[model samples]
Target: MTIYVLIAVMTLALVLLGSSVRVITQFERGVVFRFGRVRPGTRGPGLALIAPVADRLQKVNMQIITQPVPAQDGITRDNVTVRVDAVLYYRVVDPVRVAVDVQDYGSAVLQVAQASLRSIIGKSELDDLLSNRERLNQGLELMIDNPAVGWGVHIDRVEIKDVALPESMKRSMSRQAEAERERRSRVITADGELQASRKLAEAAEVMAEHPAALQLRLLQTVVEVAAEKNSTLVLPFPVELLRFLERATPPETTTAASTAATAPSESAPPTAPARTNGAVPAGRAVYPAAPDAAAVAHAVAER
Candidate 1:
């Protein structure tokens, strides 16, 4: 019976020894504690032996952890009611503190992240959140990081997943954006109109200088209208031709022209001259009581 009891005691000791032996994986770290107090440092990923009941070890995974912060509702600095949700990425830089410092680091970080989100939302304006998102995200990571560091959680990144705005506020913002776009559109259209008018003025000056571009423009217009299939095309003649003709004409006729006018009238009375000669000859017959043809012929030959 004593031999059987010795065998049972040996069996119990082997089981206890086996129980004290722990194996840690490569991705895990073990924080050792002695009598309810954590040791100064951590343990290994390989085989480790601990005195049962006196030594306690808590294993922590060293992988990067992702924690989601709950949605937080707060009023912005601009008095806008906003609901914001965020995501946090963290990893345990110090495994000992992770096991010893906080009761539950994950829960603590989540709560702190929610609070930090609220605080940031309260501090930032609505436009600041919309326009300066990177700044806000950095600020959030900074604010949440300082406290999380003590909990053995090193915050790598913080992201604002979504920001929920009130329906009324969203509509107001939409209208504001639309109005801004419209204002820009109107300014651009006005600028285009100004440019076009300036170009027209420049072209007018060119036409005034060359006096030919106007004809080209008119010709182009006629071409444009002619392409419309059977449409009547009204052609515009240049006013420069008429102006040139006006400039070339004289106001009065010269003396040479007046003399040339009198020569034609002088030669036009041949019939009258003949009639006067015949009458005179007839009258001379009456006066010829003392004259004959021989006498007239001798007088003509001597004259």
Candidate 2:
């Protein structure tokens, strides 16, 4: 009967010892509650002892938590509707406040993050959300940290994951991008043409100042064409050469006999004078004999 009583007492002492001793990991802290009231200063790593019946230890993790915020639909400040989502990185700094100040710190942080994200969406434009996400993330972190600091949660960083646009908005942006590219391409082509025109004008001036340069260019063109080994080649004649030849040639003069035949006679009437042996009459004005058709044809052939 004494052995049985001793065994019962030893078993109860072992149970109490097991219940009172708590093990905290290196990344965890023990928040002690004494009779439903939180005690000051949290227990660190290693084994912790407390009164078995009057004390309770809650383990809180100190590791960073990665929480994904769900996509929210809202109208922006510019009156554009969009859907946005994000991710948050945070960790607990004070285990006591995390345990006593909030019923569930994780859930509270999530709720605050969602509310801050929605509020940021309402205050920002679609352009800022797409282009200036870094600024928006800082603002979101600040907003969420204000309420979360009281719960012993510190926001390390916030990142906007995705911003979804409607089909109409997507199409409009695509068209805008295409138009911008086309405008740039046209401007580049126009600039190229302007440069080519200026170079060609300069080349023309150079060739005009040095006539031999034109000849050299023609020779170069001929060489390039010959290098192609083509069966046919077309050569151009310069108009200046033709004008020079025309200027060098002398004008022709008419002979006296031919001129007298072509000019109207001032001394005689329309009727021919009476001739004797192919000679003009004595009183009529004497004129040189007109050249024969054979002689005129010979002169033209000689010319």
Candidate with maximal TM-score: 2
What is every candidate's alpha-carbon RMSD to the true fold?
Answer: 17.3, 8.8
C-alpha positional error of residue 143 in candidate 1 after TM-score superposition, expressed in Å:
2.0
Residue range with the least summed lDDT across 10 consecutive positions in model 1: 287-296
Q: What lDDT score belongs to each candidate, Candidate 1 first? A: 0.83, 0.89
Please, what are the lDDT tens digits per residue for candidate 2 over residues 93-165? 9999999889999999999999999999999999999999999999999999999999999999999999999
Q: For model 1, which pairs clash? A: none
Candidate 2 regions exceeding 4 Å error are 222-229, 234-303
Q: What digit string (tens of lDDT, one per residue) describes model 1 on residues 39-72?
A: 7777778998888778988899899999888899
